[model samples]
Target: MSTLVVRRAPITRVLRSELRMVLRRPRTLIGLGLLALVPVLMGIGIAIATANGEEGGAEGLAALVIGNGMLLPIFALSIAMAMLLPLTGAMLAADALAGESAHGTLRGMLMAPVGRGRLLAVKAFGVASVTLIAVLLMALTGIISGVLLLGGDGMLTASGTSLPFLDALGRVLITALYVTLQVWALAAVALAVSAFTEHPLIVVVVSLGLVIVSGVLAAIPALDWLDPVLVTTSWDAVSEVVRDPIEWGPLVEGGLRALCYLVIGGSIAYSRMLTRDG
Candidate 1:
C-alpha cells in the first residue's frame, strides 16, 4: 500500500480566498452600501433641518453637524457600531463556518490538510478585515459628506468647548480605531455559534439576538451591575476621548470586554472544530 501527502494552503491564500468570497457576496456589498448610505442621508437631513438659519439641536452626536463636518464621521460611526456594524458583522461571521457547510465546502477544506483551528481563526480575521474596512469607509464617506454639506473645520465638545480642528481629527481617528476594536465581540460570538450549525441564518439571527439583548439590558438601571459582563458596554465609550484629559476608564473597560469575548468565543469555536472528525 502507498500513500501520498498534499500541501496545505498557506494562511495568506486562505485569507485572500475568504476575503474574496466574503466581499464578492451581494449581501456584504449591500450591507456596505447601507452603511455608507446612512451618513449621506444624515448629512442631507441635517442640512435641510438647519437650512435658512435654523438652529441645530445641541443634542448628542447630532449636534456635530453644526460643529464640524469632520465630526460627522464620528457620529456616523457611532450609529454604525451601535446596530449596523454588529448586524453586518453577524452576517459575515455567522456565515464563515456554517455558510461553508451550507455550500458543502467545509468537508473539502478540512480534507485539504488545513488545521481546523487555524481555519476558524482565518475566517474570523477575514470577517474582521471586512468589518474594519466598513468602519473606515463609513467614516471617510461621512467626513466627505460633512465637509461638502455641513462645512466647518472647528471642533466642539459635548460641553460646547472649542478645540483646534487638528485635535478633533486626532480624536476622531482614535475613537474610530477604538470603536472598531470594541465591536469584534459580535464577530467572535457569531464565529462561535457558527461552528455548530450548517444554517447560517440561525447563527446570524441568534448572534444578533444576543447582542440586542445585551444592549437592551445594559440600558436598564437594574442591569447596571451587568455592564462589565455585557459585550456592548464599552462600545460607545470611545466617545469619551472627545473630552479634555480624555477619560480612560470606559475605553479600558471596553477593551477588556473585547479581549475577553474574542478569546473565550474563539476558543470555543476552535475546540468545537477540532473535535469534529468531518
Candidate 2:
C-alpha cells in the first residue's frame, strides 16, 4: 500500500503566484516607471514655475509646494486621481480572466483544485494589491520629490489650519486607502467584462467606456440624482477626508457603492466562468 501525499494550494499561495506574475511583466514595470515619473515631473515643473514656491500662487500651491512633506502625497494624488489611477486600475484588471481565456490557459486554471470563485477572488485580490502599490508609489515619489525641491515643513489644512507632521501623514495614508477601495471595485467590474470575452483589449475598452458614459451622464442636469449611483461619480470622495473635522458620509457611501459593484461584477464573472466551456 502506498500512502499518497496530497498538496492543497492555499488562497495565499495562489495570491502570491498571481502577484509575482503580475509584477514580473515588462509592461507592469514600464507602466509603474512612467507613473512614478508623474510626480517627479510635476514637482519639478511646479518648483520651477513658482520659483520654488517663492513667487505667486503660494496659498493655492501650498500643498504642492507649501513645503509640507505630509501634503506631498495628497497633492500627487489629486493629479493622478482624475484619470491615471482609474486607467491604471482598468489596465491591471482587464487581463485577469480574459487574457487567460484568449491564450487558452483559462481552462487549465479552472482544472486546478481551486474553485472558480476562489480563483477569481484570488485574481481580484492580486490585481488590487498591485493597484494599491501603484497608488503608494505615486505618493511616495511625490513626497520624495516635494521634499527635495519645495520642502515639507508646514502642513496645512484646506481651512488654513496647521497640522502636525504626524497628523498630516495619517490623513495622507487614509486617502491612499480610500483610493485603493475605488480601484478594487473598478477591478471587479473590469474582471467581469473580461470573463465574457477572449480579447483583453475589449475588456479594457469596455471597462473605461462604462466609466466615461456614467461620468458624462452624471454631469448632465437631468441625471443629477443619478450622480450618487454612477460608478464614476465617487472619485472625489477622498477630498472630504483630508479636511478638518473629517466628514465620513461620502467616504462610507463611496465604499458601499464600490462594494455593491464588486458583488454584482464578481457574481457575473463567477457564473460565466463556471458555465463557459472555454
Candidate 3:
C-alpha cells in the first residue's frame, strides 16, 4: 500500500505569517495609524456641528447623527477601500509570488512538500481575512464615534420620524454589514489587479485607479448601465439600509452584484497566479 502525506498546514498559520509580514512593513503601520484617526476626526466634526445653539436639543442632535451618520459609514467604507484594500491585496497577492521571486524564496518553497494550489488557497484566505478585519475595525470606530458625539438616545430619520434606540442600533449594524460586503468586492478587484503586477506599488495604483474609474463611469448619465456592472457602484447600499423599512432590494441586488465581481475577480487572479512563471 502506498502511504499518502496530506498537507497539514492550517489556513490560520498562513494568515498569521501574512499578518506578521504586513505588520513588519512601515507603510502598513502608517496606513493603520491613519485609519485609526478617522473616528476621532468624525467625533470632532460631530461635536463641532452640534455645539451651542447651532443644533439645539436631542432631536437636532439625533437628526444630525442619523442623517449624517447614514452617509458617514458609506464614506468610511469608500475611503478605506480606496486606500487600504489595494495595499492589503498587493501585500497578499503581489508579495505571495513577486516578493518570494525577488528574494529567490519561491524556488525553495516550490521544492517544499506544499502544493501550489494549497499555497494559493491559504494566501487568498489570508488576504480576505485581513480585509474583513479592516472593514470591521473601520465600521466599529465610525459607529462608536457617531454615537458618542451625537448621543444615541433616539434615532431620527430624514423624514422626521424617531425610532427607538434599539431599532437604531439594529439599523447601524445592518449598514455596517452592507458596507463590509461592498468593501469585500473592492478587495477582490484589488486582488485581481495584484496578480498582474510584480511591483506592489503598481498593484496598489492600478487597483485604486480602477476603483476611481468605476466611480467616475457610474456618475455619468449615459453610463447608467455601467452602474450595476461596476463593483464600487453598490457602495451606497449602506445608505439604503439605514432608510425606513430598511429597503432590502438595493442591499440584496448590491450583494449579488458584489458576489459576481468576487467570483470573476477571484477567477482571474487565481488563473494568473497559477499560470505565471514566478
Candidate 4:
C-alpha cells in the first residue's frame, strides 16, 4: 500500500475560503448590513438628544457621556454577541462538519491527505477571525456615529466629571476593545455549541438561549451573589473604562472570567469535533 501523505494547508488559504463561504450566505450579509446601520441609528439618537437642547461643550459632552458612554457600548456589545457574532460563528462551525455530512462530501474530504485535527483547527481559526471582524465593525460604526452626532468636544464621565475631547476619544477606543473581548467570549460559546449539532438553527438557538439565560440569571436579586459568577455580568465592564478613578477591578476580573469561558468552550469544541463521527 502507498503511504498517505498529509499536507498542511496554508492558514491564509483556509481563511480566504472561509471568508468566501461567509460572504455568500444571505444571513451573513444581512448581519453585516445591520451592523453598518448602527452609525445611522446613533446619529438619530444624538439628533434627538440635541433637539432636546443637548448640544456640544461640557453640557453636550456630559449629556452624550451619560446617554451613550456605558449604555451605547453595552447595547453594541450585547447585539453583536447575541445576534451577529453567533450567526457567523454558527454558520462556519455548524457547517464545518454538518454541511459536509449533509452533502456527502465529508467522507471524501476525510479521505484526502489531511488530518482531521488539522481540518478542525482551520475551521476554528476561520470562525474566530470572522467573529472578531464582525465585532470590530460594530464597534467602529458605533464610535464614529457617537462622535459625529454627540459632537467630539469634552466628555462628561460616569462619575460626574469632565475630560478633554482627546481623552474621551481614548476612553471610547478602550471601551471598544473591551466590547470586542466580550463578543469573543460569546463567539467561543457559539462555536462550542455548533460542534455538537448537525442542525444549524439548533446551534444558533442553543447559543442564544445560553446568552438569554445568563442575562436573566444575572438580573435576579436573589441571585445577586451569582451575578459575578455569570459571564453575562462582565458584559458591562466597558463602562468602567470611562469612569473616573478608572476602576480596573471589574474589567480585570471580567477579562479573566471571559478568558476562562473561552478556554472551556474551545476545549469542548475541539474535543467534540475530533471525536464525533462525521
lDDT by residue (179-263, candidate 1, tens digit) is 7787687788888888888899998798878888998998899879998888887877867876776788888878888999989
Ranking by lDDT: 1, 2, 4, 3
Best by lDDT: 1
Clashing pairs in 4: none
Show where candidate 2 strays beyond 4 Å: 1-6, 52-66
Clashes of each: 0, 6, 0, 0
lDDT of 2 at 235: 75
- Residues 183-236, candidate 3: write the lDDT tens digits: 566667666766665566666677677777887898799989878788777765
In candidate 3, what residue range of length 10 has the lowest lDDT sum?
58-67
Give the clashing pairs for model 2. 62-66, 67-151, 67-152, 67-153, 68-152, 69-152
**Candidate 4 segments exceeding 4 Å error:** 1-6, 52-63, 66-75, 78-111
lDDT of 1 at 223: 76
Model 4 RMSD in Å is 4.3
lDDT of 4 at 134: 66
The number of the candidate with the highest TM-score is 1
lDDT of 1 at 48: 80
> Model 1 compared with the native: what TM-score?
0.91
lDDT of 2 by residue, 137-217 (tens): 987887788778767565677766777767777787888888878877877888888888889898889878887898799
Per-residue accuracy of model 4 over 138-255 as CA lDDT, tens digit each: 6667666666665545666768777776776677667666766666676677667766766667766776777778888887888898886676788766667657878999888888
lDDT of each: 0.81, 0.78, 0.64, 0.66
